[model samples]
Target: MQRILLIDDDEQLGGPLASYFQRYELALTQAVKPSAGLALLREEHFDAAILDVMLPEMDGFELCRSIRKDNDIPIIMLTARGEVMDRVVGLELGADDYLPKPFEPRELVARLQSMLRRRSNSQVQDTQNELRFEGLSIDPARRSVTRQGEAVELTGTEFELLHMLASDSGRVFSRDDILNHLRGHEADLYSRAVDIVVSRLRKKLEPLDCIKTLRNAGYSLALRRLP
Candidate 1:
């Protein structure tokens, strides 16, 4: 059984959801407050987490940040606010996925399964070629990246995104294409998560601006390094 942690104040919302998740072979542990949730996370090993955006005192964004500081577990944020910016902000803060309030239970299950699949697929090794684009180099075996011979620190997701793009420099990957590639088929086809992640990646890969955004189409990596 896959262990899932749900950090939401509303038992009304979490109760039935937890029951429903069990039907899909997911075991859920609910934490009604941020402190308890963070504590439980630190003490236990959960395959994934569902964090509510509207929590008491320290909101979900801060909670998400705290979780990322030490752990790389995939997170799905729940927000009542249907704003695009809210979704973008959550993604920027390192959430793997987000679902708006009043969502169907089936959709939530599909997303959770997809995220778990993505996480699992990322760990599988089919090939481990060291990709080099001039001064920028990626060693898949070490899962490390270096530019100009200096080590670059990247989040797991960020490194995966960069490695995917760098692997095929000429291919223009649309947002859906990249999301599906990273998060599997059940990924949201129109979320701004890709753009936010890409923006963050650009900042990290700075002084080596190779990721190029094409208006209306998508993004690509410019292999021609700057001198």
Candidate 2:
């Protein structure tokens, strides 16, 4: 069974979620605080973690970063607000995805399965192990990125976005296409979702002008620098 860590103050959310996930053979380990979640992470190895944005002391964003500090474990954040800004912030903080509260339990399970599928697919590719572009290197097996020989930490979603663009360098990817690649399908996402992720990604890949934003068209990878 796949072990999943769920960090949320709403104790009620745990019971139903746990029962629902059992259908998929996924086990849920619940934590009501950020500190407890962190401790659980240190004590056990979970396949993925789910965090709620509104937590005592440490918010989900901080908890997300705290987890990313040393582990590449996939993360999905739960939020009651469901605002575009909230999703943007969570994604910027390196969350693999987010689930709005009062959501259909089915949706959460689907996303969780999709997230796990993508993470598993990234490993053990037969064609190649790494994507090289100019001064950047992406190792899918390790889920790591390095620019100019310096390690660039990326979330699961960010790594997927970068890999999509770098794998097909110079190809324009419409917002829908990018969203489809990042998520399981082309969702009716707040258009800003793509922009925010791109903006955040740009900041991390600074001084290296590789990603290009085409007005009225889409985005593409244009690595001007040669490795």
Candidate 3:
């Protein structure tokens, strides 16, 4: 059974959610306080975490930052506000995804499944083995991209974009689709931010010509070279 740690102050919602997830074959654990959640996290191993933004002792963002310091564990933030800034801040804070409150329980389940699926798929691909396309290479496990044998440093967003494009080479993904893939349940205000990340990625992959941008359409990776 997949272990999921849920941290939320709303006891009412948290109770039902725990029951709902338990029915779906997930071992659900709930922490009503941030401190308790942190304690559980340190003592136990969980596949993923569902965190609420507003907490009594300490905010979720602080908890998230603390978690990110040592754990790359996937995190899904729950926010009641649904503000764009809040979502962006969560993303920038290393949250894997965010879902606004007053949301369907089914939607939360779906998002959790998506996060797990992505992590599982990434692991199954042998990303630690390294991928080479012509002179370009990417090691997903190390989170490193290289061109012509030289290493290239990438931001988290840039690495994610590259991973998405590379995972399904030759598939045309729209900006909205890319944003959804990255943000999951989080609301994105600037869809054009996808283009910005792609541009930065393109610069890093300079002279490789692997990622091809389609004006007004989206992006597709060159499929013939890499393996």
lDDT of each: 0.83, 0.84, 0.77
Candidate 1 lDDT by residue in tens digits, 143-203? 7889889988766677778888987887898988888877777665754778888988888
Residue-level lDDT of model 3, residues 1-227, one tens digit each, is 89999998878876778889977778788899988998999999999999889888989899888887666678888876647677667766767677888788888888778777766766566546766677877788877788788978665556677888877778999888897876564544456456566776787788878888788888998846554
Pairs of residues clashing in candidate 2: none
Decoy 1 TM-score against native = 0.85
TM-score of each prediction:
0.85, 0.91, 0.69
Number of the candidate with higher TM-score, 2 or 3: 2
Candidate 3 segments whose C-alpha is farther than 4 A from its true place: 126-128, 132-137, 141-160, 166-173, 180-227
Write model 2 residue lDDT over 1-227, tens digit each, in one string: 99999998889889988998999999998999999999999999899998888899799999998998888788988877547678888887778788887678788888888888877787766645677777888877777889889999877777788888887788999998888877878245656778877887888898787889999889999984344
Compare candidates 2 and 3 on lDDT and give the better one.
Answer: 2
Better of 1 and 3 by lDDT: 1
lDDT of 1 at 206: 81
Residue 178 alpha-carbon offset, candidate 2, angstroms: 0.5
Write down the worst ten-residue block by lDDT for model 3: 184-193
How much lDDT does candidate 2 score?
A: 0.84
